[model samples]
Target: MDHEMTPRPDRLALREWHVDDAAAALSVYSHPEVVRWLIPDMDRVPGVAAMRLLLQQWIAESTRITANGGRWAVYRVADGRVVGGAVLLPLPPGDEDWEIGWQLHPGVWGQGHEEDCAFTLASLAFERGHSEVFAVVRPGNTSSAAVRRNGMHWVGETSKYFGIDLQVFRLRKADFDRTAPEGHQPPTYADI
Candidate 1:
């Protein structure tokens, strides 16, 4: 197994994607509740084979992060189960700005897991020398908007993806340092 597949002690242990996780991932992605906010044209009920293909693609992209940068699967520390995913994708090559995105299973909704994972990912990005992290959310997604508001400043709208209106929010390294929980020190990529 690759070192990235190894769990980190400090984080909720963002792990590498695995083929075995397809069933669980399908459960999350196929659910109407979860898909409501995702890509509208997404398969409402993705099959296990399709999910496995998606997982394979994710694993491949993550492997390229050393050269291209990307996302990670958010696993729970308590059980090592895959709960969700997070990513820091560059808007344009060689640019310091990146879009940070996260999606948690509906099962963990209302329990603050998203916020915890977001904080961990943001800290990871800043420590990796990223100047800023931004999230684009739909206006009606109150829960996601709340998570964005917690540490990010509203940066207005942009019609870049999803073919729908989006509200952009950003968090600079400086603002993240001031707003993150007390004693929340940032973690270098080596720390992961």
Candidate 2:
């Protein structure tokens, strides 16, 4: 988690969120569409000042997480635009299962940034010696498509995580190796 994160040049880049990124992050987290999907654990970030405080907390918390887990800001490598964020962390309560999650601004939705972000974080978990990673989504959330495309298999609904009903998807390290080989990048829109 503390190591420098650099995804493929052709794909998205993952880095620790900085306080200066608050404005760009606001563009993603404050959107009504994005917030509706987030629901309970997160709400629409009201302003740049509030978002900066939140980022500060995240930065401080990352230091206490000794596991290979942390939150990252997702960026488009081509233009260096902040699309959203990605996270690799332990599922709460049990803290045994690894979870991978991502969020992208509505402005960049359906352009494959979701899949790239999800895959990038999950791959990082695997490389850090985790055997598998999970993704839990709100029942009706459309992000499931990106999760599936990233090679995560549906594992059915469960309220075990976050004490809320949600659909869960999982991916193993072996499954990832088959889906995206070394040096292989996720498909672009044209490639799809």
Candidate 3:
């Protein structure tokens, strides 16, 4: 990931996360409805201090280009609201696994945002010289299953990543390109 980035399709943009996003992050992430099915601990909500510390971590991650990848804040083109966040980060060392994940506000749930954000970020990864994009979904999270439905194939169940057992899904650039309309490509950080 570039230190400065804004990557997306026409309707969505993935911007670098900023301190200003703290309230928005808390608003969405701390709410039970958003994290319940997505995170390992559905009951886990980062407190204000914890969230701020996390924001700092996100800032650091955004600057690095690694298998662990980085997180980008998702913005709606029509209104510029920070609706959610997406990440294309690395798995554990030597596995060379790149993971894609999303955390969206429940207010905007079921509107295809996760699919759009994940697809764009995965495309960004491919465009950036990465081999494959993966997503780890907890077994019962049919909400997160939408990304798998978008085009990712189920690899299997595993606890190898983050030490959390999850249903793994994957999408390769070859497959992404084949499924995309002709001439389709994910936008670059410079595109914004």
Candidate 4:
């Protein structure tokens, strides 16, 4: 899956996560309401420095994700805030299905940022030539589960992801075709 990523600027660009993003990321990831929906390991993030190290690691791993697909800081177009994060990476080392995930600050929740970021990234993934994209969500995290309305379909549950009972949602390239044009652009905050 190694390949170059497509550049996006209209909705929100999927740029590499950075050390500077650590504080903003912490603002989103450290919130009890938001982090609860993420993988349990995130519970170990103690403070800003730990979050900075994590973000540094994210920058270190950026090349791999970019080679396979991409991950990003979820750069907001309107005000240029780092709302949260988004990624379309390989399904672990042995699997073929690519995974898409999004995390947005609760302050920005219900503002459509999650949908726009996820949509833009997924569309970029299709452009990068992946046959399918998947999103794994905690059964209780109804917020992330909203990928269903954006063209992903329920594919049952699995504990394979982070050893948790999670609901899986999938969207094939055909699913994209039936749902959106090949070059479709996702909506931005201004467009909302």
Per-prediction TM-score to the true structure, in the order listed = 0.81, 0.87, 0.82, 0.82
What candidate 1 gets wrong by more than 4 Å, as runs, is: 1-11, 39-41, 66-68, 92-96, 161-163, 182-185
Clashes of each: 0, 0, 4, 0
Question: Could you give candidate 4's per-residue lDDT for residues 1-192 as a string of tens digits?
Answer: 211112334344455677877888888888888778775346836789999988888767667554556567776665667777877777753657788887877887875556655566667777677888988888788687458767889899988776778898888878775554245543322110
User: Residues 65-97, candidate 3, lDDT per residue (tens digit)?
Assistant: 554367878767767777778777777756488
lDDT of 1 by residue, 1-192 (tens): 111212234335565678898887777778877667763346654699998888888888777666335667777676767777677677543544577777778887776566666676677677677777877777787778545645788888876655677787888888786666544454446634
* Deviation of model 3 at 33, angstroms: 2.7
Where is model 3 more than 4 Å wrong at Cα?
1-10, 38-43, 46-49, 93-95, 181-185
Give per-residue lDDT, candidate 1, residue 146: 46
TM-score of 3: 0.82
- List the global CA lDDT of all models: 0.67, 0.77, 0.71, 0.69
TM-score (C-alpha) between model 1 and the true structure: 0.81
lDDT of 2 at 48: 98
Which pairs clash inside model 1? Answer: none
Clashing pairs in 2: none
Better of 2 and 4 by lDDT: 2
TM-score of 2: 0.87
Q: After superposition, how far is residue 115 of candidate 1 from its true place, in Å?
A: 1.2
Please say which candidate is ahead in TM-score: 1 or 4. Answer: 4
Error of 1 at 11 (Å): 7.9
